[model samples]
Target: MSDTIQPPFSILFVDDDQMSRHHFARAVSDDYRVHLAQGADEAMVLLKELGPEIAVLVTDFRMPGRDGGHLLREVAQAYPQIVRILVTAYADKDMLLQTFNTGDLFRIIEKPLRMDSVREVLKQAVARYAERETRQQRLLAMDETLAFLAHELNTPLAAISLFARSVENDVAQEYDPQRQREIGAAATSMLNNAQYCLTLISSFWATVHKSGGQQPASGSGVREVRAARLLATLLDSYPFAGLQREWIDVDVHGDFVVHAMPNCVALVLSSLMSNALRALDGCPAPSLCIEVISEPEPEIRLRDNGPGIAPEVKARLLLDPVTTHAGQGGHGMGMIFCNRIMQSFGGGLRIESTLGEGTTVTMRFPGSRGRIRDADGEQASVTRTV
Candidate 1:
């Protein structure tokens, strides 16, 4: 690891001739860890053992069994992170053209090995190898992250489909009108759950690689969003079928706000509020309250007087891609999608509940400057997140 005596980049040299291997190894041994391969078969074995470390692969164009181009193509497909360099002495013009078509050769070293040219080409190959290695590592990480997200979303989607079919066949035919309604509602909820899962996946993917801040679609000044004003708007848009206003309170001391993508904040707040109201269904004298707490952190807490989340379901509520009370709805993608939206704006979501008491869902928004700026640079007088 010392810079003064840094080892040379590892090089894999494959040729049918023993003398050629010895000469090449002797020439490069001072700097690089040279591996001599008798043929493509031996080269493959060395490659399998020393992947990322084997920086450059020098293969003769014409070998006994498999030709150089064929080997290089295999290397490119199998281990694209390694740099491939082909050496050919008896290449016809047609074969030379074909080499380019076969694999991405770093540099073609015409054989009748000129030591100086080999040194220069090998140096270039090492540099190319470094670049390729970096790119490959990034691609591998991204692929893994995407795969994990896909797997997490699939479980909920499958459950949603199965439960939806059961509700359609069994509950729909029940004689009781109330039972039928509940069954229909359950079906609708399941479909929403699937949509919610898809939204979380799409939002997280977008936010993970987001370059800049969230910008409003219209590059306009941010509209002031007071918690009180925001709550009124939500109530007007979606009148909670049976709303309880006795404990509802909005205490905005200075003006809680956040810079965001215009309608995004509103949509997020409304969704959270709606979810809270729906969660209170069937509870005794169910009451839903919205309180804007300003100290420590600017946030809106939506509490409901309903049978709180069960212990088992509470454990995986927001963590899992799908979450819903069993038998309530076969689909449970709401909270997960809500979490994604909050994360998009440097915000967070919290859930607090007691089995027999009620559930409280808090959405926190980080404070920005006195006047929050939208993506368009316009000042937002008020900010509200439901």
Candidate 2:
């Protein structure tokens, strides 16, 4: 007992019965720091008051005002960082009928409470919370490091443009006016691209990392951006080498706001472009048309006139890594990453292709009424969570 280390975060116990709250808190207070809430409403108040200090939520199913099931669902959306547990008289039937989403509730406790079993569950729940916090810290560190590198690179890139301009001026009349203009434009484009990438990295970092005296949105990294605005930025800053830019056409008929990490969106586009370029390498004509469509749903579609994906390869593309360009350093994680980002927004991705025709990839986004909040800043309604 003396050797047992207290958890970094506290446990919250919510029950309608006064005697029950005291008994439960009294039993576990030695090993774990516990907060008592008489009902669901009180628990919510405590959550806002304590914030990040509370990690595990244990509430009785039959509570006054609001039931524990509702509390769990609300917490899962608002503060996904908190691990939730339900205390119910009838565990099996109540859990199955009430909470079909296993993702929300962590564990179900049966009454009358056995102190030993309850203690064990609390211990495991604390362990889970500790692991989640550790992972978040690691991810935040990596993201901040990348942001720092991007910020540091911006200065050197601007200096390079200035140096190039000076070198060109020193050798004036060696090139015609039109040639000089072209050289200046190219240098400016290079600097602009770096600056754009830095902006995206900074934006993503700010969204994911807690900043600007803003309360943390646990387990989410996405922010809202208009599809048209994001696409323009992506295309303009994209390092389109050689004649690749000429092969691409973008048409924005309708725009929709999508929730996602901007840099991740750019990465997804880069992956798709790389795939299309390789597929159309030896073809007589290659074209990639990107369109923002508003119809049955808000969507972004990418159509490429290249050798279409084979039936076998297409079938396995979303499920697993199916690639023909293994020799060229391709691991086939592009579509996988794209699928994850789409799903995080409560949207989906579809790939359609035919032999000798082309491939069309559609990115379906959550409409105005719906937004799925996945871990890494997907926004939703719950205001109280760690």
Candidate 3:
């Protein structure tokens, strides 16, 4: 039944024997775009022409001109993506070791291939190809994410550093003893806190990439605190602290505490803030207001006054990576990170927008409060929204 399912990828069979090529093609022809190559030269031509579309390569190890391992190595170097498989008559130890070292071969199928074994190997090849593609995309995503963080945080980081240094310089030069000491201490505190915050951001950037865009299993539980208060504290630490930022204008309409990872909550809130700010860009006196309503179900509505998202943008807001401003770069990993965090905490993200009006992003944790549970019921707690 799975074989009958639509194949989303293409594959190539590169073997000199006519029967072998026919057999491989016939086996996988029902699914996938199967191409056949009679020799290494023909395989090279096919690869160059359809490299991007092809997802896997099946080649024989003992061909007349070029052996399977050599041909596959060349293909791996040239294409890197097409999953390689070596089909040979015998499991030659030396050649097998060489193939393994080459590092792109997906599997080794013995010659006079059994139909079932060949099917299984091809199936695995498809899965491996899918995984490889996913990994590549995630890596590209991490790169984009880092660029975004650098772009968005650069200005604030510079300002914080500059202002803190200026405060110190001014304090040291002041003539009055009491005034000088007071200013010096205050400047020192501010500078220290700024440094700490910068360190945290740097650590977060490293963690995001290190995670491969996956959320860590930090689990769920509040840190002996209330939900709204926790959210407020998170907003307080954001770069726009004390600015005319809209995220600060928030009201908790529910009386509840959440037993969830505080860092996860913070990450989600940060993502919401970032989305709000992006949506509010270019608007006249942009403002964002968050309202937490928990009676029917725990939900935080993040509304903004900036121009609403386009229909297309709204449709793909959660599906695709957020578009970074030209040269204002980012790895587009923030939202995905937030989404993963939410899912890990038994929650999901929702967005509604009206172009030229405004947009709102809502986060809802579906699990019930009082007896919050994860698979094994690891003592999860829910802070009811008041």
Candidate 4:
């Protein structure tokens, strides 16, 4: 079996002077993948193309057109993961101070650069990059594990709540002995499932915490959930009432099944749907369409005819918690939470929007392998049985 390996750390050296760029690249070529850019414009292009792979950026401060500080600021906003270093021949104290204050500049190299000093700075930059990456990966893994745990615990709790309600209803009314027995059996099953899930969660945390905080394997408590039924449950219980509820539409392409913990999928959909509803608050003739496509992949597309996201908001939408509707109590963590859940499922979430037009949020899940009956007694499509 082939093992997955990370590519070598890369550095992008940007300088208007050809000799400086060439010398820098040559010095680090042996230890890193060195990329050369002549100016800030070229550096921007390279940054776009190799943002994720390039770990460090070294740019000359006194370049024509946009300066190194400009490039560093851009990288800080768009690709904060990239470590930035500034090189300058003339050491202007005020300029250096401003650069440090405004940009994510890691270090500054003085004029007539010493090869040894350059090498040391490059080594430190690589070390810092690796440290940040490791910390981020650990946090992300922990976030995923926690989301899975919450979903696992929530699903069984929901089942218990549902079964408890059934028992309450049966006892409240004049019930047949057969109906009472059936309700009792369902309650027993719910208790058993809850107990099993609680045990699994306990063991999951113990293993994860003991194993140096590594991510726990997925599908530990995964169960098949029907797409159509899931959507129906969400829509029926949606906070919207009366005519407002009529604005939402759900289209399921045949019977589709998603092999995941039911609550995890529901949590993702709920977050997306809630955002859509909020976006449509003041729109004229607002409508939300949810389409579930089974073949090719199990994907859900939630499209809304509402005011699209602003450019500034769209740029950092999933990167951090940001809210466009701060006045209306928007926490801005909904999409981030949803993104984490999808990633934990080995899936992804995508959002596309045109200002003044609308926004479409696509959620792709692991494809189904076979067929299974949903809670509504309807068959759903899947690729295989887990």
User: What tens-digit string does per-residue lDDT give for candidate 2 at 1-386?
Assistant: 44677765898999999989999988998898899998878888999998699989998888878888888887787789998888888747746466747437778778899999998998898888887875664454344334333433443355556656666676656778887787776676566546545655565565456443232344557455777887887777555656778888889888876544445455555556556766877778989999987644577888998989999999988789777765433556557656655554456567999989999987766666554333344555322111
Better of 2 and 4 by lDDT: 4
- For candidate 2, the 10 contiguous residues with the lowest summed lDDT are 377-386
lDDT of 3 by residue, 1-386 (tens): 24575566688888778988787777768776788888889999988898877888888888888787788889878998888888888767987997879846678778688988887888898888887775664454444445434544553355456556667677546468876776665565455446535744864655556655563333464135467876777666565532446434888898455544444465567657765775565666878888877766576778887778788756775667665432333445555555555554556566777877788887766546433334353544532220
Quick one: best lDDT, which candidate? 4
The total number of steric clashes, by the backbone 3 Å criterion, in model 1 comes to 6
What TM-scores do the predictions have? 0.42, 0.47, 0.56, 0.52
Task: Give the TM-score ranking, best first.
Answer: 3, 4, 2, 1
Best by TM-score: 3
Candidate 4 weakest lDDT stretch, 10 residues:
377-386
Once fitted onto the true fold, the runs of candidate 1 whose alpha carbons sit more than 4 angstroms away are 1-9, 15-32, 38-45, 48-53, 61-81, 88-95, 98-104, 111-120, 127-151, 155-195, 204-386
Model 1 lDDT at residue 378:
54
Per-residue alpha-carbon lDDT of candidate 4 for residues 1-386, written as tens digits (9 for 90 to 100) = 22433346789989999998788777667677889999999988988888888999988899899998898898899999889998888768999999998996899988788989988998899889988876675566456646645654554566677777777766768768888788877876576556645554555555456655643334656345688888887676544533557788888886577655454576578667767877897787999999988766667899999999988888788778897755433456666767776665556677889899999998867554334333353554422211
User: What is the lDDT for 159 in model 1?
Assistant: 55
| Whole-model lDDT per candidate | 0.66, 0.70, 0.67, 0.73
What lDDT, from 0 to 1, does candidate 4 have? 0.73
RMSD to the native, candidate 2? 15.6
lDDT of 1: 0.66
Q: How many clashing pairs per prediction, in order?
A: 6, 6, 24, 9
| C-alpha lDDT (0 to 100) for residue 67 of candidate 1 | 86
How do the candidates rank by lDDT, highest first?
4, 2, 3, 1
RMSD of each: 12.7, 15.6, 10.9, 15.4
